[model samples]
Target: MKAKNFLTTGLVLLATFSSVVKAQVAATDPLINQVSHLLIETNKQGLVKAKYASAETRLADLIKAGRSDEARKQMSDLISKIASDLATGQVKADDLKNRSIVTAKKLQKAQLEAVNQYVNGTLSAQDLVNTLKPLNSHYTALVSVLQRYQDVLRSGQSTAAPAQLATIKAGVTDKSSILYARFRLDLLGYSNDTTKDTLTDDLTQAITDFQKNEKLTADGVLGSGSWKVLNQDFAGQISQLRISIDRSRWLPDNLGATHVFVNLARQQLQLYVNSELSMDFKTINGKLERKTPILFDSMTHFILNPTWTVPQNILLEDKVPMFTTNPQKVLDLRMKVIDDLTDKEVDPFSVDWSKVTENNIPYTLVQKPGKGNALGFIKFPLTNPYSIYLHDTDSRNLFAKNDRMLSSGCVRLEKPFEFAEKVTQSMNMMNWSADTLKDATENLSPEAETSTRVKLVKSIPVYLFYLTADVNEKGQVILSNDNYGIDATTYDIISQK
Candidate 1:
């Protein structure tokens, strides 16, 4: 069932790419026919290609052409003026106020074609104006992010940190470095209310707090580990922002009225309600070797007191080896070995250990729900090919650590019970809430130990993406590490296309 859904989504994406490739370069073919082969020579040589250099060259050609000057100028000015409104987004205060439903539908169709303008080749001056006008309307918010950084680059000032100093402890006499460190700490939510750059006691406390929150040593010393994190300047962030904007072109102008949006690159999950952000959570995604694939699926149900059916790879590589190393640990864990063909429990001791291998494992291994169960109390199951689901973890300590890419092809929620409640209420799943889920899983008796899947009133969409940079609540750019090693590759893909 998951496989079918995945295949369908893959087909849709491939179809989108096909349409993007074949889309007409002109809104009206006659407009392009009127301005055919209007090429810009880019007369200036030996000069570094600036941010809007291409647009500027095209503008000059249009001014020379005289006939298409007004049309081309509009396109050039729009690209140049995106930085005017950075914080409020290029969107109006209300979604409906700025949108022309009839125009928006046409713009959506044209925006899909505009991506090919960068990929296929040059466009005549008039056709470029027509193609860009609709795209500017539909993709203004996304385009603004790209243009914001472009404006920064055009101004000849780089936001990337220029240098890093040697290990400077708390009592350092260098005021310059200390002031910079204080700024970094303040940005990280560890504020110190001091005007002195002498590293006061209050500043030291802030440094220690920042270190603790980042899962670093609480020594309050400025060292190599801390410097790496402090150096995320805007110049560096723009590259990923460009990549994110390109990827956003393929997505819907609006994701959904309500949806679960997960950025695997950032290792964060967001829940949107009524097209507005309602809650966000820290998430642990799949590890490097076992990647969490990008999926556009829906959450159909959740399980209470969930039992884990160990997959074949884990059964051979993890469970079998661990149990073989210490047989007594198996009994302590309350693991059950069952026959593969029949729904019958088998005695663990009776199985011949010497015969078990990757090629010939004829039994299923399952862990019962309770303390030390891999899934802590509750699980939110989604339909996907990888059998991936969102659930609580028994190892809650990992949540404090900064690097949270530690799961095996599934997501671990920071507050699973709370998430379960929000999702159930939102989806009308059994008219449930946090308290109801708490009552269902709190029972300690054997009668309530088994897995119970509750159906949803309506399935909720979940989108797993790879956005590496995005705006914050205050509308400032934030960057994330490239956990999946796709930032560069994705950048290249978008640039080529």
Candidate 2:
């Protein structure tokens, strides 16, 4: 009787210990259940429908069946779609619902794997918590940042001015201020000794660098102009870059091994060889009165001695009056008057000056190409409706100026000869040397009655883009001048879409 009671007591104690161990496991392993409860709450808020819930359940079951890799891939694809919808401003309640379901499925899978790994002695409990904590914090921060920007955009505020900074105090915090300061420091590559309070020198140097890059006045003060640029939300800028990258996905993957790329907003041209930048130069864009068109094509031919057929607007407004008012002025400027009906050059003494009216003339005036010609020595030809091309300019001094938007519509290159040489060599073609260019200019005479044609051995690609910001080869972000006033328009269009 005593042996039987002892055995029974031992069995009862064993049963009680097993129950306690199971309870401990259940209490500690709540990650999967926590994620599952979150999904259920999101669904109650009308975030997910029946079909998505069913799919997510199936995905979770598959993960339990040890198909975690496939489940994770599916979840990643769904997350990417959700991100895209958010970027395009098309996020519906249903989209969020579906996202929650997918996220729940992924979280469940991750938790199961984590628990199993811990049981197998591959991961400690502390390690699991540490791994998840940072990820959760980062996601929360990202969502908060995105929501803040979205609210600001939706408010339909006008341009952010210095006076408006006080009004936005409700939306900003010390954390945000610190983040912006850190970002500015990173952009300028400040030393480790730089601190928040004594950041005057760093800020001054950064402002100077920003001004130089944007081609603005290089004063090292955070005035209205500089503050306007620096105050932009860094997250918004990153989002804009992402949108641009997506838009560029429709473009041809390979432009060429070598080509010329022009960014209209920056007013710069870059030469790329084998996906690497070989050289770059500043360029003069079209004047405000005449805007440059976005275009993509190949340069078919080039002209060594190019004639500038005086455009009708210029001829009617400026040239005709100067010739009529002062015949000496026309002669001094190397212009000769020609008869309307005869198609022959006329002497200054022969023209009936008083009879020249808008209705009477049937003449076409042409300017011969020379050193003093409007188009200096070379012209690169392409097909476009605007009659625009890249050409050499007689006013080389203008290139030295930071802002060079003096052209009618065509692009004026700083170093035309060098650019032409590089482009021609890239295309396996030959171009005239500096001596040849000079000779061609000097050889233009009255006796040569017709324009000469210069053909290239090969064609080179040309891409005209408008980018206010870009990443350089060294992964540095370059902010350029928005001379055309397109930033606001672009931002609106992107946000709306």
Question: Per-prediction TM-score, please?
Answer: 0.64, 0.55
Q: Model 2 off-target regions past 4 Å? A: 1-182, 185-211, 216-228, 233-251, 327-329, 336-342, 347-361, 428-454, 490-497
Clashing pairs in 1: none
TM-score, candidate number 1: 0.64
lDDT of 2: 0.51
Runs in model 1 with CA error above 4 Å? Answer: 1-143, 158-235, 427-431, 491-497
lDDT of each: 0.57, 0.51
Which candidate number would show the highest TM-score if scored against the true structure? 1
